[model samples]
Target: MAPKVLIVLTSQATISSVDKPTGWYLPEFAHPYYKLAGKCDITIASPAGGEAPLDQGSVKMFEGDEECQKFLKEESSLWKKTEKLESFKGKASQFDAIFYVGGHGPMFDLANSAISHDIIREFYESSKVVSAVCHGPAALVNAKLSDGSYLIAGQQVTGFSNTEEDQVGMSKAMPFMLETDLKKNSGSDSLFVAAAEPWGSKVVVSGKNGKLITGQNPASAGPVGEALLQALGA
Candidate 1:
Protein backbone atom coordinates (compact mmCIF):
# COMPACT_ATOMS: atom_id res chain seq x y z
CA MET A 1 0.00 0.00 0.00
CA ALA A 2 1.11 3.56 -0.61
CA PRO A 3 2.21 5.55 2.40
CA LYS A 4 -0.61 7.38 4.10
CA VAL A 5 -0.37 11.07 4.99
CA LEU A 6 -2.70 12.56 7.53
CA ILE A 7 -3.63 16.23 7.07
CA VAL A 8 -5.00 17.81 10.21
CA LEU A 9 -7.05 21.03 10.10
CA THR A 10 -8.55 23.31 12.69
CA SER A 11 -12.30 23.26 13.12
CA GLN A 12 -12.31 26.52 14.95
CA ALA A 13 -15.31 28.55 13.82
CA THR A 14 -14.46 31.98 15.10
CA ILE A 15 -11.57 34.38 15.43
CA SER A 16 -11.71 37.59 17.42
CA SER A 17 -15.48 38.00 16.98
CA VAL A 18 -15.25 37.29 13.27
CA ASP A 19 -17.10 34.18 12.06
CA LYS A 20 -14.74 31.77 10.39
CA PRO A 21 -15.83 31.15 6.84
CA THR A 22 -16.16 27.49 5.90
CA GLY A 23 -13.13 25.53 4.48
CA TRP A 24 -9.37 26.16 4.59
CA TYR A 25 -6.96 28.40 2.75
CA LEU A 26 -7.18 27.19 -0.86
CA PRO A 27 -3.51 27.12 -1.74
CA GLU A 28 -2.42 25.87 1.64
CA PHE A 29 -4.63 22.81 1.37
CA ALA A 30 -4.89 22.40 -2.41
CA HIS A 31 -1.23 22.66 -3.27
CA PRO A 32 -0.45 19.90 -0.83
CA TYR A 33 -3.54 17.95 -1.85
CA TYR A 34 -2.62 18.01 -5.54
CA LYS A 35 0.95 17.01 -4.82
CA LEU A 36 0.22 14.22 -2.37
CA ALA A 37 -3.10 12.93 -3.67
CA GLY A 38 -1.41 10.97 -6.43
CA LYS A 39 1.39 9.62 -4.25
CA CYS A 40 -0.36 8.77 -1.00
CA ASP A 41 -3.71 8.15 0.53
CA ILE A 42 -4.52 11.37 2.41
CA THR A 43 -6.77 11.44 5.43
CA ILE A 44 -8.26 14.75 6.53
CA ALA A 45 -9.09 15.29 10.19
CA SER A 46 -10.05 18.30 12.29
CA PRO A 47 -10.59 19.23 15.89
CA ALA A 48 -14.35 19.08 15.43
CA GLY A 49 -16.19 16.54 13.26
CA GLY A 50 -17.95 18.94 10.93
CA GLU A 51 -16.83 21.73 8.62
CA ALA A 52 -13.63 23.63 9.29
CA PRO A 53 -13.35 27.38 9.04
CA LEU A 54 -11.80 28.92 5.99
CA ASP A 55 -9.94 32.21 6.06
CA GLN A 56 -11.69 34.80 3.95
CA GLY A 57 -8.44 36.61 3.40
CA SER A 58 -7.01 33.46 1.92
CA VAL A 59 -9.91 33.18 -0.47
CA LYS A 60 -9.36 36.71 -1.69
CA MET A 61 -5.63 36.27 -1.88
CA PHE A 62 -5.97 33.31 -4.24
CA GLU A 63 -9.17 34.29 -5.99
CA GLY A 64 -7.36 35.29 -9.15
CA ASP A 65 -5.77 31.87 -9.44
CA GLU A 66 -8.18 29.66 -11.36
CA GLU A 67 -6.85 26.35 -10.04
CA CYS A 68 -7.23 27.51 -6.46
CA GLN A 69 -10.70 28.90 -7.14
CA LYS A 70 -11.71 25.54 -8.54
CA PHE A 71 -10.38 23.84 -5.46
CA LEU A 72 -12.46 26.07 -3.23
CA LYS A 73 -15.60 25.73 -5.30
CA GLU A 74 -15.51 22.10 -6.43
CA GLU A 75 -12.78 20.07 -4.74
CA SER A 76 -13.16 20.98 -1.10
CA SER A 77 -15.69 18.36 -0.01
CA LEU A 78 -13.27 16.06 1.79
CA TRP A 79 -11.98 18.90 3.90
CA LYS A 80 -15.44 20.30 4.39
CA LYS A 81 -16.57 17.03 5.95
CA THR A 82 -13.40 16.09 7.77
CA GLU A 83 -13.47 13.57 10.59
CA LYS A 84 -13.09 14.78 14.13
CA LEU A 85 -9.73 14.07 15.72
CA GLU A 86 -11.51 12.33 18.56
CA SER A 87 -13.42 10.11 16.14
CA PHE A 88 -10.40 9.03 14.12
CA LYS A 89 -10.38 5.28 14.52
CA GLY A 90 -7.05 4.67 12.86
CA LYS A 91 -3.87 4.30 14.85
CA ALA A 92 -1.22 7.00 14.57
CA SER A 93 1.23 4.32 13.45
CA GLN A 94 -0.84 3.70 10.34
CA PHE A 95 0.34 6.92 8.75
CA ASP A 96 3.78 7.74 7.39
CA ALA A 97 3.51 11.51 7.92
CA ILE A 98 1.30 14.31 9.19
CA PHE A 99 0.69 17.92 8.09
CA TYR A 100 -1.21 20.56 9.96
CA VAL A 101 -3.08 23.13 7.86
CA GLY A 102 -3.41 26.57 9.39
CA GLY A 103 -5.66 29.59 9.34
CA HIS A 104 -6.53 32.16 11.96
CA GLY A 105 -8.85 29.65 13.52
CA PRO A 106 -6.02 27.44 14.74
CA MET A 107 -4.75 30.11 17.08
CA PHE A 108 -8.13 30.15 18.72
CA ASP A 109 -8.73 26.42 19.11
CA LEU A 110 -6.02 24.03 17.90
CA ALA A 111 -3.74 24.63 20.88
CA ASN A 112 -6.42 23.91 23.39
CA SER A 113 -7.49 20.70 21.69
CA ALA A 114 -6.23 17.66 23.61
CA ILE A 115 -6.87 15.22 20.79
CA SER A 116 -4.98 17.35 18.27
CA HIS A 117 -2.04 17.59 20.67
CA ASP A 118 -2.09 13.81 21.11
CA ILE A 119 -2.07 13.20 17.39
CA ILE A 120 0.89 15.52 16.98
CA ARG A 121 2.78 13.91 19.87
CA GLU A 122 2.02 10.45 18.51
CA PHE A 123 3.45 11.34 15.12
CA TYR A 124 6.44 13.04 16.67
CA GLU A 125 7.21 10.24 19.12
CA SER A 126 7.01 7.71 16.30
CA SER A 127 9.54 9.77 14.35
CA LYS A 128 7.15 10.36 11.49
CA VAL A 129 7.45 13.45 9.33
CA VAL A 130 5.57 16.08 11.32
CA SER A 131 4.70 19.41 9.72
CA ALA A 132 2.66 22.56 10.31
CA VAL A 133 2.29 26.00 8.74
CA CYS A 134 1.25 29.53 9.75
CA HIS A 135 -0.86 29.65 12.85
CA GLY A 136 -1.02 25.88 12.73
CA PRO A 137 2.16 25.81 14.78
CA ALA A 138 0.12 27.13 17.65
CA ALA A 139 -0.86 23.54 18.29
CA LEU A 140 2.75 22.65 18.96
CA VAL A 141 2.96 24.97 21.94
CA ASN A 142 1.19 22.39 24.04
CA ALA A 143 2.57 19.20 22.49
CA LYS A 144 4.91 17.20 24.72
CA LEU A 145 7.26 14.41 23.79
CA SER A 146 7.50 11.09 25.68
CA ASP A 147 10.36 12.46 27.77
CA GLY A 148 8.01 15.25 28.84
CA SER A 149 9.86 17.85 26.81
CA TYR A 150 8.32 20.18 24.25
CA LEU A 151 8.68 18.68 20.79
CA ILE A 152 10.01 21.92 19.35
CA ALA A 153 12.96 22.18 21.73
CA GLY A 154 16.10 23.04 19.77
CA GLN A 155 14.15 22.75 16.54
CA GLN A 156 14.84 25.50 14.00
CA VAL A 157 11.31 26.33 12.89
CA THR A 158 9.22 29.25 11.62
CA GLY A 159 5.56 30.10 11.69
CA PHE A 160 3.30 33.13 11.38
CA SER A 161 5.63 35.48 13.20
CA ASN A 162 4.73 38.23 15.60
CA THR A 163 6.05 40.67 13.03
CA GLU A 164 3.73 39.19 10.44
CA GLU A 165 0.89 39.32 12.90
CA ASP A 166 1.46 43.04 13.40
CA GLN A 167 1.62 43.52 9.66
CA VAL A 168 -1.78 41.92 9.36
CA GLY A 169 -3.05 44.07 12.22
CA MET A 170 -4.10 41.02 14.22
CA SER A 171 -1.28 40.99 16.73
CA LYS A 172 -3.26 42.94 19.23
CA ALA A 173 -6.32 40.70 18.94
CA MET A 174 -4.65 37.29 19.04
CA PRO A 175 -4.66 35.64 22.44
CA PHE A 176 -0.92 35.11 22.21
CA MET A 177 1.77 35.60 19.62
CA LEU A 178 3.06 32.39 18.02
CA GLU A 179 6.65 33.65 17.88
CA THR A 180 6.68 34.45 21.57
CA ASP A 181 5.07 31.14 22.50
CA LEU A 182 7.42 29.21 20.22
CA LYS A 183 10.42 30.88 21.84
CA LYS A 184 8.98 30.14 25.24
CA ASN A 185 8.45 26.50 24.26
CA SER A 186 11.52 24.95 22.63
CA GLY A 187 11.97 26.75 19.29
CA SER A 188 15.02 28.85 19.94
CA ASP A 189 15.68 29.70 16.32
CA SER A 190 12.29 30.83 15.17
CA LEU A 191 12.57 33.22 12.23
CA PHE A 192 10.31 35.48 10.15
CA VAL A 193 10.33 38.69 8.11
CA ALA A 194 10.69 41.59 10.50
CA ALA A 195 9.28 44.14 8.06
CA ALA A 196 7.31 42.31 5.40
CA GLU A 197 3.54 42.09 5.41
CA PRO A 198 1.96 38.71 6.24
CA TRP A 199 -0.36 37.74 3.40
CA GLY A 200 2.15 35.38 1.74
CA SER A 201 5.79 34.48 2.27
CA LYS A 202 8.26 31.63 1.79
CA VAL A 203 7.96 28.48 3.89
CA VAL A 204 10.71 27.28 6.28
CA VAL A 205 11.70 23.70 7.11
CA SER A 206 14.48 22.69 9.45
CA GLY A 207 15.98 19.74 11.29
CA LYS A 208 16.49 16.53 9.35
CA ASN A 209 15.17 14.36 12.14
CA GLY A 210 11.41 13.84 12.37
CA LYS A 211 10.74 16.35 9.57
CA LEU A 212 9.42 19.58 11.08
CA ILE A 213 8.33 21.89 8.24
CA THR A 214 6.63 25.22 8.84
CA GLY A 215 5.47 27.84 6.36
CA GLN A 216 5.50 31.53 7.19
CA ASN A 217 2.18 32.27 5.52
CA PRO A 218 -0.06 31.22 2.65
CA ALA A 219 2.55 31.94 0.00
CA SER A 220 4.71 29.16 1.39
CA ALA A 221 2.05 26.49 0.96
CA GLY A 222 3.26 25.02 -2.32
CA PRO A 223 6.89 24.91 -1.29
CA VAL A 224 5.99 23.48 2.08
CA GLY A 225 3.86 20.82 0.41
CA GLU A 226 6.71 19.92 -1.89
CA ALA A 227 9.07 19.77 1.07
CA LEU A 228 6.78 17.40 2.90
CA LEU A 229 6.47 15.20 -0.19
CA GLN A 230 10.22 15.15 -0.59
CA ALA A 231 10.65 14.23 3.07
CA LEU A 232 8.14 11.42 2.65
CA GLY A 233 9.99 10.26 -0.49
CA ALA A 234 6.64 10.17 -2.20
Candidate 2:
Protein backbone atom coordinates (compact mmCIF):
# COMPACT_ATOMS: atom_id res chain seq x y z
CA MET A 1 0.00 0.00 0.00
CA ALA A 2 1.12 3.52 -0.66
CA PRO A 3 2.04 5.67 2.30
CA LYS A 4 -0.70 7.88 3.64
CA VAL A 5 0.14 11.56 3.81
CA LEU A 6 -1.86 14.40 5.26
CA ILE A 7 -1.24 17.91 3.92
CA VAL A 8 -2.30 20.67 6.30
CA LEU A 9 -3.10 24.19 5.04
CA THR A 10 -3.94 27.36 6.86
CA SER A 11 -7.57 28.40 7.18
CA GLN A 12 -6.95 32.06 7.81
CA ALA A 13 -8.04 33.93 4.70
CA THR A 14 -6.66 37.40 5.28
CA ILE A 15 -3.91 39.27 7.07
CA SER A 16 -6.15 41.73 8.88
CA SER A 17 -3.38 44.03 9.98
CA VAL A 18 -2.17 44.59 6.44
CA ASP A 19 -5.61 44.40 4.86
CA LYS A 20 -4.23 41.78 2.52
CA PRO A 21 -5.71 38.42 1.61
CA THR A 22 -3.57 35.42 2.54
CA GLY A 23 -3.78 31.71 2.93
CA TRP A 24 -1.76 28.81 1.54
CA TYR A 25 0.57 29.80 -1.27
CA LEU A 26 -0.21 28.24 -4.65
CA PRO A 27 3.27 27.01 -5.55
CA GLU A 28 3.84 25.61 -2.10
CA PHE A 29 0.75 23.43 -2.33
CA ALA A 30 0.77 22.82 -6.07
CA HIS A 31 4.38 21.74 -6.30
CA PRO A 32 4.12 19.29 -3.44
CA TYR A 33 0.66 17.98 -4.18
CA TYR A 34 1.54 17.04 -7.72
CA LYS A 35 4.81 15.47 -6.64
CA LEU A 36 3.07 13.10 -4.23
CA ALA A 37 -0.20 12.64 -6.08
CA GLY A 38 0.34 9.28 -7.75
CA LYS A 39 2.78 7.93 -5.20
CA CYS A 40 0.82 8.46 -2.04
CA ASP A 41 -2.66 8.55 -0.62
CA ILE A 42 -2.83 12.27 0.05
CA THR A 43 -5.44 14.32 1.87
CA ILE A 44 -5.58 18.13 2.01
CA ALA A 45 -6.88 19.56 5.25
CA SER A 46 -7.18 22.76 7.28
CA PRO A 47 -8.09 24.05 10.72
CA ALA A 48 -11.58 25.06 9.71
CA GLY A 49 -12.45 21.92 7.66
CA GLY A 50 -14.08 23.82 4.80
CA GLU A 51 -12.51 25.55 1.84
CA ALA A 52 -9.01 26.67 2.69
CA PRO A 53 -8.37 30.08 1.16
CA LEU A 54 -5.58 30.80 -1.31
CA ASP A 55 -3.25 33.73 -1.19
CA GLN A 56 -4.18 35.90 -4.17
CA GLY A 57 -0.74 37.39 -4.17
CA SER A 58 0.73 34.00 -5.02
CA VAL A 59 -1.52 33.72 -8.03
CA LYS A 60 -0.07 36.90 -9.48
CA MET A 61 3.46 36.01 -8.48
CA PHE A 62 3.41 32.50 -9.95
CA GLU A 63 1.30 33.33 -12.97
CA GLY A 64 4.05 32.19 -15.29
CA ASP A 65 4.88 28.94 -13.53
CA GLU A 66 3.60 26.16 -15.73
CA GLU A 67 3.09 23.58 -13.03
CA CYS A 68 1.48 26.08 -10.73
CA GLN A 69 -0.90 27.15 -13.45
CA LYS A 70 -1.72 23.54 -14.28
CA PHE A 71 -2.65 22.89 -10.69
CA LEU A 72 -4.74 26.02 -10.50
CA LYS A 73 -6.73 25.16 -13.61
CA GLU A 74 -7.21 21.45 -12.99
CA GLU A 75 -6.64 20.58 -9.36
CA SER A 76 -8.01 23.69 -7.72
CA SER A 77 -10.85 21.64 -6.33
CA LEU A 78 -8.44 19.73 -4.10
CA TRP A 79 -8.52 22.55 -1.62
CA LYS A 80 -12.15 23.45 -2.07
CA LYS A 81 -13.15 21.07 0.69
CA THR A 82 -10.61 20.07 3.30
CA GLU A 83 -10.84 17.75 6.23
CA LYS A 84 -10.80 19.46 9.59
CA LEU A 85 -7.53 19.27 11.51
CA GLU A 86 -9.57 18.26 14.54
CA SER A 87 -10.88 15.20 12.73
CA PHE A 88 -7.46 13.65 12.75
CA LYS A 89 -6.79 14.01 16.45
CA GLY A 90 -5.41 10.79 18.02
CA LYS A 91 -5.18 9.33 14.51
CA ALA A 92 -1.58 10.00 13.68
CA SER A 93 -0.82 6.31 13.37
CA GLN A 94 -3.07 6.09 10.37
CA PHE A 95 -0.72 8.19 8.28
CA ASP A 96 2.94 7.95 7.42
CA ALA A 97 3.54 11.70 7.44
CA ILE A 98 2.06 15.18 7.86
CA PHE A 99 3.06 18.16 5.70
CA TYR A 100 2.19 21.78 6.43
CA VAL A 101 1.79 24.05 3.43
CA GLY A 102 3.03 27.63 3.65
CA GLY A 103 1.92 31.22 3.25
CA HIS A 104 1.82 34.30 5.45
CA GLY A 105 -1.51 33.11 6.75
CA PRO A 106 0.00 30.29 8.74
CA MET A 107 2.07 32.81 10.65
CA PHE A 108 -1.09 34.27 12.09
CA ASP A 109 -3.25 31.19 12.74
CA LEU A 110 -1.31 27.93 12.81
CA ALA A 111 1.48 29.53 14.78
CA ASN A 112 -0.62 29.87 17.90
CA SER A 113 -3.15 27.10 17.48
CA ALA A 114 -3.19 24.64 20.37
CA ILE A 115 -4.94 22.06 18.21
CA SER A 116 -2.32 22.42 15.50
CA HIS A 117 0.36 21.92 18.14
CA ASP A 118 -1.41 18.88 19.49
CA ILE A 119 -1.86 17.33 16.06
CA ILE A 120 1.78 17.92 15.17
CA ARG A 121 2.78 16.38 18.49
CA GLU A 122 0.66 13.33 17.75
CA PHE A 123 2.51 12.83 14.48
CA TYR A 124 5.93 13.55 15.92
CA GLU A 125 5.48 11.34 18.98
CA SER A 126 4.36 8.53 16.69
CA SER A 127 7.71 8.76 14.93
CA LYS A 128 6.02 9.88 11.76
CA VAL A 129 7.24 12.62 9.43
CA VAL A 130 6.53 16.24 10.39
CA SER A 131 7.40 18.69 7.69
CA ALA A 132 6.68 22.20 6.38
CA VAL A 133 7.96 24.96 4.11
CA CYS A 134 8.23 28.73 4.22
CA HIS A 135 5.74 30.10 6.69
CA GLY A 136 4.41 26.61 7.13
CA PRO A 137 6.97 26.16 9.90
CA ALA A 138 4.69 28.45 11.82
CA ALA A 139 2.75 25.27 12.53
CA LEU A 140 5.78 23.94 14.35
CA VAL A 141 6.55 27.14 16.24
CA ASN A 142 5.58 26.13 19.76
CA ALA A 143 4.73 22.48 19.17
CA LYS A 144 6.21 20.37 21.97
CA LEU A 145 7.00 16.72 22.39
CA SER A 146 5.50 14.41 24.96
CA ASP A 147 8.45 15.30 27.19
CA GLY A 148 7.36 18.96 27.04
CA SER A 149 10.37 19.91 24.95
CA TYR A 150 9.78 22.11 21.92
CA LEU A 151 9.77 19.86 18.85
CA ILE A 152 12.22 21.96 16.88
CA ALA A 153 14.57 22.28 19.85
CA GLY A 154 17.88 20.66 18.98
CA GLN A 155 16.51 19.91 15.52
CA GLN A 156 18.06 21.39 12.40
CA VAL A 157 15.37 23.28 10.45
CA THR A 158 14.74 26.09 7.98
CA GLY A 159 11.79 28.20 6.95
CA PHE A 160 10.88 31.63 5.55
CA SER A 161 13.84 33.69 6.66
CA ASN A 162 13.84 37.01 8.45
CA THR A 163 15.57 38.62 5.50
CA GLU A 164 12.98 37.29 3.09
CA GLU A 165 10.22 38.67 5.25
CA ASP A 166 11.87 42.06 5.28
CA GLN A 167 12.52 41.90 1.56
CA VAL A 168 8.84 41.47 1.00
CA GLY A 169 8.12 44.24 3.48
CA MET A 170 5.96 41.90 5.54
CA SER A 171 8.28 41.69 8.52
CA LYS A 172 6.39 44.17 10.59
CA ALA A 173 3.04 42.87 9.41
CA MET A 174 3.74 39.28 10.37
CA PRO A 175 2.83 38.40 13.91
CA PHE A 176 6.32 36.98 14.32
CA MET A 177 9.25 36.30 12.09
CA LEU A 178 9.25 32.59 11.18
CA GLU A 179 13.02 32.28 11.13
CA THR A 180 13.36 34.01 14.46
CA ASP A 181 10.66 31.94 16.15
CA LEU A 182 12.13 28.76 14.71
CA LYS A 183 15.53 29.69 16.07
CA LYS A 184 14.10 30.46 19.45
CA ASN A 185 12.26 27.14 19.52
CA SER A 186 15.46 25.47 18.36
CA GLY A 187 17.30 27.02 21.32
CA SER A 188 20.04 28.30 19.00
CA ASP A 189 20.49 30.40 15.88
CA SER A 190 22.89 28.11 14.05
CA LEU A 191 20.38 25.29 13.97
CA PHE A 192 17.98 27.44 11.95
CA VAL A 193 19.78 27.30 8.64
CA ALA A 194 19.17 29.42 5.54
CA ALA A 195 20.15 29.58 1.90
CA ALA A 196 22.99 31.68 0.50
CA GLU A 197 20.49 34.47 -0.16
CA PRO A 198 16.84 35.40 -0.06
CA TRP A 199 14.18 33.56 -2.12
CA GLY A 200 16.56 30.67 -2.63
CA SER A 201 15.80 27.01 -2.28
CA LYS A 202 16.88 25.49 1.03
CA VAL A 203 15.47 22.34 2.55
CA VAL A 204 16.64 20.90 5.88
CA VAL A 205 16.09 17.31 6.89
CA SER A 206 16.68 16.17 10.46
CA GLY A 207 15.63 13.48 12.91
CA LYS A 208 15.91 9.71 12.47
CA ASN A 209 15.07 8.65 8.92
CA GLY A 210 14.88 12.33 7.98
CA LYS A 211 11.42 12.58 9.50
CA LEU A 212 11.62 16.24 10.43
CA ILE A 213 11.92 18.31 7.27
CA THR A 214 11.52 21.99 6.37
CA GLY A 215 12.08 24.35 3.46
CA GLN A 216 13.21 27.95 3.56
CA ASN A 217 10.90 29.68 1.10
CA PRO A 218 8.49 29.32 -1.80
CA ALA A 219 11.40 28.30 -4.01
CA SER A 220 11.95 25.27 -1.79
CA ALA A 221 8.43 23.92 -2.01
CA GLY A 222 8.91 21.24 -4.65
CA PRO A 223 12.15 20.02 -3.16
CA VAL A 224 10.51 19.64 0.24
CA GLY A 225 7.98 17.29 -1.36
CA GLU A 226 10.77 15.30 -2.96
CA ALA A 227 12.52 15.07 0.38
CA LEU A 228 9.34 13.81 1.98
CA LEU A 229 9.06 11.09 -0.65
CA GLN A 230 12.61 9.97 -0.11
CA ALA A 231 12.07 9.93 3.65
CA LEU A 232 9.06 7.69 3.18
CA GLY A 233 10.98 5.39 0.85
CA ALA A 234 8.31 6.03 -1.75
lDDT of each: 0.75, 0.92
What range of 10 consecutive residues in model 1 has the weakest lDDT sum? 187-196
Clashes of 2: 0
- Pairs that clash in candidate 1: 23-54
Among all candidates shown, the one with the greatest lDDT = 2
lDDT of 2 by residue, 30-149 (tens): 998888999999988899988999999999999999999999999877899898999898899999999999999899889989998999998988999999999999999789988999
In model 2, the runs with Cα more than 4 Å from the true position are: none
Q: After superposition, how far is residue 190 of candidate 2 from its true place, in Å?
A: 0.5
Could you estimate the TM-score for every candidate? 0.89, 0.98
In terms of TM-score, how similar is model 2 to the real structure? Answer: 0.98
Residue 81 accuracy (lDDT) in model 2:
87
Give lDDT for model 2.
Answer: 0.92
Number of clashes in every candidate structure?
A: 1, 0
lDDT of 1 at 72: 78
